[model samples]
Target: MANDDGMTYADAPLRLGRSLDIATNRYQVSGAIRSVGANASLPTDTTDVLLETGLPAVDADEVTVGDQLRIGGQTVATVETINAHATRDPNQHRVLVGLTLATISDGDTTRFGVTPVRRGNTLSLATDEYELDGRIQRVGTLEPPGTPTIRTVTLEISEVREDFAETFHAGMTERADDETIARVTNVDVEPSTLITTGDDGSVNVVDHPINRDVTLTTDLQVREATTGTTFKGRSLQQGSTVVLDLGTTTIEATVVNADA
Candidate 1:
């Protein structure tokens, strides 16, 4: 049932972002977002963006508070809180999500872009503009009025460092490899093992020389030599071109190996 405005809670027309949680099955859904206010101390420093998406009665039951939402593969927020409001019709309800921005850490910087906000996820809240570039902070669900099923999602979002001009272009590329040994280092290898031969008059013993030429190829995850973050591994793929930025000159190389 729709309100006097003829807009039901299920009538979210805009599509929000995608799920940040890669483990969950990916899904696409339409929803609405609004900006309430920000921290008074630094209002512009951090902003709050709210999202409301509806689910079918059956599907609403499966929606959890911790669920993730994303747009364009960039995680917007986690389900902070959920609310289901019953309409005049008994069979339908609305799911309102109070989503906070995802905290844009250094690790998130690479995958999300120089700046977290994307044009696709922007929303017109009152007179100001807001974007989805936050993570879910807290969430919970509430019982719907009457018999309608309901869910509630909440979020606490932080602001992204402004860099609208940094949006991706057709030829824009991110340089991953850094030649600074100070930050990154060559893979450490184990010392060679050796076996000694038995002396002529001494007890007889077998001696074997370990293979030294064998290159160490590991299937383990590659982390930053400095921060131990998964930023590089997450962004770069095998065959991807990598440019190591050193203060003096840039070193270009190909990604020989990579994995999730």
Candidate 2:
């Protein structure tokens, strides 16, 4: 992209635009993408991207670090920093954003199941020809002396990993046990703990007070009425006890007055 000055420079090389097919809700911006490993002495899987775009003076504060950017296709990047270039160049009034590529898959020892892929979670990077499934190893930002007011955001992204290699299946039922079942009274009372299902289908077992009533069902799963986080059970005896195990968390509730 060319700066405001008549003099042109080939600094920002890669195209940084929203991939409507991958992330329709992504913010529209333009810049370049570069691999951080270009200067690496060792191998790594990550890349840094620079986004220099015009923003309204009023909404400049809206953009901040930690904001996610859909770099290209399903590959999402995290904002590392936002440079206004006020001190470096007084003329070029644009946002020099720094971004680091996000990872395709992560590991969590406490929980299992394909690292919990949500609907909107990135699956792979899409290109005009094909898609890429890679990992981001490192990311950072830098600024060299220039007149066009260009900020270099470096990233060490590795595409060596095969596309769609890692795979996992949700086998939480195999981890279920009998201890997760318990009995509690079903009344117009609030429970100390609650479990809810996120829009992405991820289970959220947190401590929140919620009221419940006696709506007996033959096959009752451990569920938080407020969030709809249902945990499958083995021996779900409705009138006797409730069995619910969400893998990450478990709850046992028994009705003191079963008929009530």
- What TM-score against the true fold does each predicted structure earn? 0.23, 0.22
Q: Ten consecutive residues with minimal summed lDDT in candidate 1?
A: 149-158
lDDT of the candidates, in the order given? 0.33, 0.33
Top candidate on TM-score is 1
Candidate 2 segments whose C-alpha is farther than 4 A from its true place: 1-44, 70-75, 85-93, 102-142, 145-260
- Across 74-173, the per-residue lDDT of candidate 1 in tens digits comes to 5555555554433333344344445444443332231122234432243311101222222322222221112211111111111212232122122222
User: Model 2, residue 153: what's the lDDT?
Assistant: 14
RMSD of 2: 25.1
Look at candidate 1 and tell me the lDDT of residue 256: 49
